[model samples]
Target: MNRTEAHFIAQDHLAREGLLLDRLDWDAWLDLYREDAVYWVPGWIDEDTLTTDVRRQVSLVWHTRRDELLDRVVRIRSRKSVTAMPLPRTTHSTSNVLVESAEPGRIVAAASFIVHEHHPRLRRNDVLFGRYEFEIVQEAGDAWRYARKKTILQNDLIPTLVDFYNI
Candidate 1:
């Protein structure tokens, strides 16, 4: 495929991922990634550039593998999770999409997203904004797998209460 074709495919993949998250399709969303994929919600803007220990560098959230992500999903789905007792309605809006580059089988994408969450029980309509930096690879035929997803939150240092179900 050409660069334009690869970019279009990557953009579509990101759009689908946003929709899946908005619908809370955990299983389908998780399946869109490779088994060794890394999901990082960095605590600092330059976390990627910094070579220091992520744990010591104030990382927000990090999942090194697909199994870890699955575990988190399972934990949130469990009945014992108090934080998730009253599920919140979430809508993810993604925009400002830019495809940085495209190789033979890989595409680099960047986009801005706002996750609006509303929970009647908590009387909250919080908006979580971030930028997504993704490395997507074409697998079998038209299948796309997320090799890496780096989410950089707008407010990284703030101590905020996040529901376990929030993604």
Candidate 2:
């Protein structure tokens, strides 16, 4: 497919992920991850160098494989994960979706995302703004799956505890 088409497909996948999460479709959402996918949210670093070393620096959440992702999904769905309870009303807003690189069977995509979370008991809504960097692989029938996803949260002082539960 053309790069433009690939870009839209990837964008659609991102949108689908949001909808799945909002609807609490854990199984279908888990399908978005590839067998060897890496899902990472890095920890804070110095302002001068906007990058943090994934190897040495601590990350908020890092799942090395799909199995790990499955475990997370199971916990969140089972009402065992502390961060998962109450199911905050969330809306994922994504923009500036750019296809950075498109190879034969893969696409490198980037986008800015804003997740608005509202808890029934909370006084105000919590917003998480970040950039999503993804490596999406083309699968059978030219379908797309997430090979890796790196989220960079802009807020150094996050409003609340950060976790992958919303994802």
Candidate 3:
């Protein structure tokens, strides 16, 4: 497919991801990712650099396997997670989607995103803005799944708990 076509596909995929998260549909959201996908949000090391190594540096969020995400979902569903209790209502918006590269089986896309979240318990609202880089791979039967997701949060001074859903 041409770059334009690839851009549309990537944009659609990202929009669907945002919709799933907004609805708090954990199962469907999880479906967008591969089993061994890497979901990472690196912490800033300084004014200009971010932590590159997950094993040795601090990260806001990192799950090497989808099962780890599933475990977190389970906790949220079971009401066992205090941080997730009275889950925040969120709306995710993404813009400026660009297809960095598109090959036969893989596509790399990047976009800017902002998620507005309202905490039920705290009666507070917060917004998180960041840039997302996704490595999406084509699977069987026209399926596309996130092979790796790198989220770069511009505002690193998060006031509350940070999870996959919020940013």
- Report the number of the highest-TM-score candidate: 3
Instruction: Please give, for residues 73-162, the per-residue lDDT of candidate 3 as tens digits.
Output: 999999999877899999999999999999987899999999999999999999999999999999988989999999999885787788
Q: What pairs collide in candidate 3?
A: none
TM-scores, all models, native as reference: 0.86, 0.91, 0.97
Candidate 3 Cα misplacement greater than 4 A, ranges: none
Candidate 3 global TM-score: 0.97
Query: How do the residues 1-167 of candidate 2 rate in per-residue lDDT, one tens digit apiece?
Result: 68898788879989988888777787888888899999999877676444466788788888889999888777777889765466677888788899988878888999999888887656568888989999999888856789999998888578876766453
Per-residue CA lDDT of model 1 for 114-153, tens digit only, reads: 8778876778677778788899987888789999988767
Alpha-carbon runs more than 4 Å astray in model 2: 48-51
Give the whole-model CA lDDT for all candidates, comma-separated: 0.76, 0.82, 0.93
Quote the lDDT for 122 in model 2: 62
Candidate 3 — what's its lDDT?
0.93
- In model 1, what is the error at residue 86, expressed in angstroms? 1.7
State each candidate's clash count.
0, 0, 0
List residue ranges in candidate 1 displaced over 4 A: 45-52, 156-167
